[model samples]
Target: MLIDRYNSQLLMVDVQERLAPAIADIAGVEAQIAILLRTAREMAVPVIISEQYRKGLGGTLPSLAGLMPGVQPIEKMEFSCFANADLQAALSGNPGNATILCGIEAHVCVLQTALEMRAAGRLVFVVADAVGSRRPESRSVALDRMRMAGIDVVTTEMVLFEWLRSAAAPEFKPVSQLIR
Candidate 1:
């Protein structure tokens, strides 16, 4: 199915300082997420970033913050951002009923958020390359679980292209410039 840009928002889930260093394939995941953020910014997509607990886990990565300035970061204590009331309100106010999810700890925050979003009647599309876990098995399990729950699994480039929708679009140059 085509990713409806007008009906999509980027939800960057906890790419926190202390947690990110230990995740598997950390470098690759970071790179992909950077690209994803750049694409989202270039395309005027709204982004919601959640810091699991700022007093403990730390803020979203600097690279991500650089791309999405003034992102409505929903600080949460819950493992899932969906569990927070303020986050829910932010989500409901967005133009999209679809979430393009990314960030760390694939089997935990990423997984939980995807499932909850789906349950809330929002279409969840995860950027696989932008998600990671300390244990590969755990990450794989989460992906399986998300797929089982009918979440649409996608990669960073796929999301970029899908959001662009057509090569002839006026934003084509800026969007395509991201991949290069």
Candidate 2:
């Protein structure tokens, strides 16, 4: 299914300062997420960000945090964002039924969240290139598991173009420039 921009929200999971450094190719992952965040803002798509164990993991990376000024990251101990009441409430508040996930430890938080969200009957799309784990093998296996469970494994460009839908969109120029 195509990702309907008006019917979807962006969820950034645990791209914290302390935790992010441990993910392989974290720089590339963050860059992709940045593109998503910027596009989300440009398209008026609601965004929800989560930070796992903020005290230990520290807050979202300064570079990423700055992308969405004034947006507070949800603090959660649960690996699945759906398990956290606050995060759940935040998600429930958004009208969108589809969620786009991007973040660290694809095998852990990202994987669990995608499965749980999918099971809950919401359309879940995990941006593969925007998610990472310390071990590439772990990320690979997690992607396979998510796919087997019927989750859509997508790339940043796929999302960008889907969200834009066409070159006639007013956001076309600015959003398209994000990747370049």
Candidate 3:
């Protein structure tokens, strides 16, 4: 199924400072996430960001934080973001039924969150290239598990074009510039 922009929301998991450098190909993940964020903004998709134990991991990366000025990251101790009331409220408040996910330590937080969200009846899509773990094996396993649980594992570009849905879309030129 295609990702309809009007029914979708972006959920950025814990891409925190101290954890990011450890994730495999950190730069690649960040780059994909940047494109996702920029596209979300241009399309007016509501974004919900979460930070896991900000006191320890620190906040979301500075570059990502800058892209989302005035939007505070939901701080949570729960590994599964769905366990946190605030995050749940954010998801509940939004009109979106589809959630596009991006973040770190894919085996843990990202994995648990994806499974839970899918179980909760939300159509969840994990941006494969925009998610990572401290170890390549962990990431690989998480992606496989998420897919097994029926989550749509997707790439940033796939999502961008799916949301765009057409070359003639008003934001096409700007979104095209993003990938190039």
Q: How many clashing residue pairs appear in each of the predictions shown?
A: 0, 0, 0
Model 2: which ten-residue window has the lowest total lDDT?
88-97
Candidate 2: residue pairs that collide: none
Q: Over the stretch 1-180, how does candidate 3's per-residue lDDT look in tens digits? A: 999999999999999999898889999999999899999999998899999999999989999989989678999999999999999889877644799999987999999999998998889999999999989999999999999999999999999999999999999999999999
Ten consecutive residues with minimal summed lDDT in candidate 3? 88-97
lDDT of 2 by residue, 1-180 (tens): 999999889999999988888889999999999999999989988899999998999999999889999689999999999989999888777545689999988999999999988888878999999999999999999999999999999999999999989999999999989988
Each candidate's lDDT (Cα)? 0.86, 0.93, 0.93
Q: lDDT for model 1, please.
A: 0.86
TM-score list, all predictions: 0.94, 0.97, 0.98
If both were scored by lDDT, which would come out higher, candidate 1 or candidate 3? 3
Q: lDDT tens digits, residues 1-180, model 1?
A: 888788888888889888899899889999898888888777888788889889887888887787777775789988887888988787778645688999878999899888988988888899888899998898888998999999999999899888988999888898788778
| Model 1 weakest 10-residue run by lDDT | 88-97
